[model samples]
Target: MNLYSAVSKSPHRSGTCGPNYLQRLLRLDSPGTQTILSGPESKAMTHYLRSQHDVIIVGVGTAVADNPALNCRIEGVGLKGQPRPLIIDPSGRWEVESEKGLAECVRLAEEGVGKGPWVFTSLAAPKRNQKWSQALDKVGGAYISIPSSDIDGKKDLDWSKILEKLAQLGMSSVMIEGGGSVINTLLQEKYLHLIDSVMITIAPVWLGQGGVVISPPRRADASGQAIPAARLHQTKWQQFGDDVVMCGRIKQ
Candidate 1:
């Protein structure tokens, strides 16, 4: 996974941190990004965000790919109150028996190190998936039924709806850790207005065709296949171990 040779050859022109940069490097259009990222540098960045934000969020793809414990993993560095793990599992695909299931979250809750993860599934999830929801509850994890009866398709979790719901639940801020599709959705939906900071890590690996990209084949609009684009404000970058951590403020 030498990201340098793979990604350096295809650099982003915006010099901003977001899906375009991610696509240029990793060719992924969603949030499932942990695999291509560097271990030490990536975890350190994840820990810092978990410590800072009130909540940490990942799309379901990421949840399955990483099965990551959202809390700060480092031993000594810790936050006063742990950031809650929030997964956008709209389809309820995580099986109870899977290794990356809610098992780790249950363990953490039992150990008192962090609160159990919150699983957000669409209200219209298949009736058969109810078992998974029940399993999440059985493990002390919370299930949030997002109100999306109007639509049954993939774009059920509107950005504003998610943010407002999190706010109502007492979350002041959130950090989005994700796969490329999720990141691409945020860009296409213009979620930048609600966001404060944008952070990205470019590792030394190029997944190429073996991996996914951030651009999903969204339904064409009347505007005729125009892909939305955005720019970041107050951009900056620095080295984090072997990775390049790109940081910026989302431009309005």
Candidate 2:
């Protein structure tokens, strides 16, 4: 499991901006702060990430909330082959609503690339949104599930089973991105093997009730005390313009 975070930032703000006059102004360092990752750097990072991971995983909240197109073939970073797209939709709700959800499946089919637009849900089969299932089926994609009971006590969802299924479809590695709860669950269950971060330092803008960037939940023993610390291997960082990309491996 190779986890990665892909973020773009400007000194004026902390995320990417669309092409416009204002965006050009924001990129200038007149105010003593600079955007990290020039347009070229961002394109390179996207290409690198797509090449590195066979599968990319994100939570339902991310799928629904951000409605990200989540594909690798953006303008400058042409995806050589499609990487598998995986979504952890425990409740089976996101498939029906998200435009990003629909686009991810459709684009893969249109491009005729990669293994799947896979959905990892608690449901054993696809539901009422048969249109979504049909779209995926047309592209040789699938919806997979294991018993939710298996995940009950920080027991780890049967990631091995999930990996086996992906292997059958030819995926060799996975990149897990998140919307906090899923990140917390994966960390607590010790399911992650590596982590990558595209660190963004912003202009202190606050969204008082927004989701947390990282939330590694603690597991408690029977007496309710936190479990002992797990060893973290080491972290490596690379400069992407003024921002940093940090990667860490979890020790076995």
Model 2 quality (TM-score):
0.64
Off by over 4 Å in 1: 1-36, 77-80, 96-102, 127-140, 149-155, 216-228
TM-score of every candidate relative to the true structure: 0.72, 0.64
Residue 247 lDDT in model 1?
Answer: 74
Candidate 2 local lDDT, 46-82, one digit each (tens): 5455555666666676666554455565454344544
lDDT of 1 by residue, 102-164 (tens): 456556755767767787777776654566556656646677877653333544676666666
